[model samples]
Target: MTTILIKQVSWQQHQPELQALRQQVFVVEQKVPAELEWQADDEDAYHWLAYGPQQQVLGCARLLKTGTLGRMAIAKTARGQNIGLRLLQAAMDFAQQQLGLAEVHLSAQTHALGFYQKAGFVSEGAEYHEAGIPHIHMRKKLSPQPQLGISNGKFFVSQHKNTVLTMAQQCRRQLRILDYNLNPAVFDNQALVDAVSALARRHRNSSIKLLLIDSQAVIKRGHGLLKLQRKLSSSIAIKQLSDDTGVSDNLVLADDCGVIVQSLVNPETIWADFNNKPVAQSKIDHFEILWGQANANNDFRLLDL
Candidate 1:
């Protein structure tokens, strides 16, 4: 657990040291062909190097603008303490933050796929050989994020675990309705429906989430939630669950056994059933796959015409 610090390299200052380190690690130790080791594009890339307190290069990685992350190498002295994962994370962050890449791809040595998987990269296509080593192309998608607005003034907000509730008596939360590929009106007339409707009316223009999961085809029907979702109108995002993937939508449903809705003022506070669960990201990933393939080309505003 030795402390390691990473420094962003400035071409004029760190290039020589970086080149020397690469030559030692890639050309000599790893036997990466010389021609492939030094590309003309190195001068334009954002480079980072991890250094011990004495200023020795412990690890390094580079970010290329083409969304290709490559050339990560660590000193032989630092091989087993997980320095590589840190380098990879730094490279991935730079690729997304500085280069604005949507998807980051890496050509990982076959044996190292497990390492990449831990960092959120999935293998693509099939295995191939690069520079006399077995390799696989791996990719990780960066979530599309919006500029987060800062709240200048502190408002009196209450917390329910992570779920935020407004000051309203019966309607202080945003509820995401889960539709199991069915109509949205299945729960409209129940006590759950009346409570949610009253809350929505209280908020007026705030957005409440409704998530639909259609498992009837897979599970052969039993849940009442799935039935309500099928009847809901369009203009809503209803994602289907599959065994192969995880949920893709950050938009999640409520956790109550009955219908769930919360105040829009603290939408981020609502916790889904998967809250604090380790596999929650996998669930969101599953929803994203279905969402990506769903047709959304219609002009939403012109639907009335």
Candidate 2:
């Protein structure tokens, strides 16, 4: 892999290299019309350039304050070397930080869908031709809002609340956890190991199962927890949940307090207990209902292993 340095560029300083790359890729190679290519207010637009160790510009992109991101180009020599991703990352970061934009939208060429997808941009609708080339709108959610609460001390979004960045959980006490469709942050193996170890120390000789939900296990990073499960061994049984399924409402019944951790995208409607604690009884019941449906048959496999 080639080493690349990303830096914000003044429109004037980067204009020559940027226009050349754009003319090469979008105009000459992709047949984009010169009329539509470079016109309008580019002076106010923020531009970025990627450079090699020798300060040779390898890629460039511009983020106009229209909530629209466009004109990203990578030199032909830098193609397949991931310079485009670096440019997009820089562009998105600038748009979020300086512009405070909620979403960065782009009309991505159809063939480049995979590239954008890897960079976290989701395709929205049907493809249309622009300058005779097929294109589609793509958007990436830049500021990944946390649900609330940290796992041990490091920042981890609450997949349930969709807003709060909760403090990390390091206590050994049994927790009365709540459920919300949350996108919990990916945890390192050591953290998972610590969680499993803590659970073991708290619930010694008790039947404690590791309920792996669809969003957390398969969707987010399936293989991560699978590795943690192996390191944990027979201490906790791994249960898998289908995408449509949820936890059993009686998830609280098996233990003194339940630990509910899932992505907050599809939150369980309930938020607090009668006493206003974070634990929600009704949602816990729903979790139990879904929990019973999860296939108990053990199947934790890691691709790398």
Candidate 2 lDDT by residue in tens digits, 1-305: 34566678787877787788788888998888999898766788888888886888888888889777888888888888877876786677566645778889899988889999988889999999888889999988776422222221222221222111111233233322222221243233445445545665665563334454543434335444445556655555556566543333212212332233333442222121112123434444555565577675343454234
Model 1: CA > 4 A from native: 146-305
Q: How big is the positional error of residue 30 in model 1, measured in Å on the Cα after superposition?
A: 1.9
Alpha-carbon TM-score of each model against the true structure: 0.48, 0.48
C-alpha RMSD between model 2 and the true structure? 14.9
Per-prediction CA RMSD (Å): 19.3, 14.9
Candidate 1 lDDT: 0.54
- The Cα error of candidate 1 at residue 239, in Å, is 51
For residues 123-154, could you state the per-residue lDDT of candidate 1 as single tens digits?
A: 98988888898999999997542221211222
